[model samples]
Target: MSNLLPEEAEEKLVTVCRTAVGDSLRSLTYFNRFDYVQVYLREDLEQEADLNSFIGNEWHDFKMTQDAYRGSELGDYEYTIRVFENGYLVRITVEDFGVFVTTDGISMQDFEALAAATTEILDEWAIEE
Candidate 1:
């Protein structure tokens, strides 16, 4: 069903996240330009299955960020964390594919770890340039 990573690969990705922080992870949604798949952990997925549509604007925003901050003194892009009243949303992306995960309150160290793990996996599965 996924155009970027296969089911087994998707499972592995989620497993890695689970292992990293255990039950804190609520859901992970993998998305590209056209399609997406949501793997729920702590909550049942609601009626909306359109993860790509939900994040459509974010994709554009991320691209703008990459272009706007090119060559800045700041180091490489790592992760974006959006705080919600109930939990946290963490997004990690590369040039082609990316994933956003929801988790119960987690520490900054855990956030960095998730971002690193995600980026490594993304490199492994990225399309050949």
Candidate 2:
């Protein structure tokens, strides 16, 4: 299992996303879990090839629309939640580091909420106090 706490993980994800997209972002709230938030970016599809390449020949169970790509991984003591950014067709992946999130794409408010939710869930499985 991961040693990091959810809060800590979330912080890490925010840093990574911000670094990639920047601090100013646009977002819309479309879905939510107890500690998770689903956001839609305001951007349009930019890189269709790059986005399609990520899901090439891979089996994915989408949660939203047919355009959405989703997957999960379960290990001996680790679990991961992955969501691909469909906005701007930016093939961004949000990974929960047992407590936080890591992703690529432009910054947006929706992304912030997603990062927060991912961290909250990871916190429950942290290996660190």
Candidate 3:
């Protein structure tokens, strides 16, 4: 794993995601000094009308738990994919940050491949990661 900066990672993610999702992607934002990339999508009919929507109805169920000092939810309906290269981390949240997926200990190429695959699954929306 090469030591990649957050900006570089963000660029790679955006490219991979764009190739995956095409024009529906809304925004990909970096938070905590690039520790995470919040991937937001437009709430359009294409997204809402899918019976098998990857991002499910529990989109707004995320909440910060005081006991665990973390966020928790109950379904995999929403999707979030987090990517990490070198030691930096990037989190891609889906549907109002509903689902959270985190990835670490991987090469840049592998990370890009993963992002591409995920984008492919989310073909209904555009991604700006």
Cα lDDT of candidate 2 equals: 0.34
TM-score for candidate 3, residues paired by index: 0.29
Best by TM-score: 1
**Clashing pairs in model 3?**
14-129, 24-125, 24-126, 25-126, 25-127, 56-77, 82-101
In Å, residue 105's CA in model 2 sits off its true spot by 10
Report the lDDT tens digits of candidate 1 across residue range 1-129: 466567788888898788776789988888777767775546554545456566796577778888888888997676788899988888888887788888889999899888888788887877654
Q: Rate the local accuracy (lDDT) of all candidates.
A: 0.79, 0.34, 0.38
User: Measured by TM-score, how close is model 2 to the native structure?
Assistant: 0.26
Q: In model 3, which runs have C-alpha deviations exceeding 4 angstroms? A: 1-5, 33-129
User: Which scores higher on lDDT, 2 or 3?
Assistant: 3
Q: Which segments of model 2 are wrong by more than 4 Å?
A: 1-5, 27-129
Off by over 4 Å in 1: 1-4, 43-50, 127-129
Model 2, residue 121: distance off in Å is 14
Per-residue CA lDDT of model 2 for 1-129, tens digit only, reads 122223454455445445444633333111112122323233642322332223431213222322342342432222223455633322222232122232345445555555555445335444343
Q: How many backbone collisions does model 2 have?
A: 11
Per-residue lDDT tens digits for candidate 3, residues 1-129, read 223234555455556655544443444433221133344433441333232232232232222222233345653332333333423223344432322223325455654554546545333333543
RMSD of each: 2.1, 12.2, 14.2
- The TM-score values for the models, in the order shown, are 0.87, 0.26, 0.29
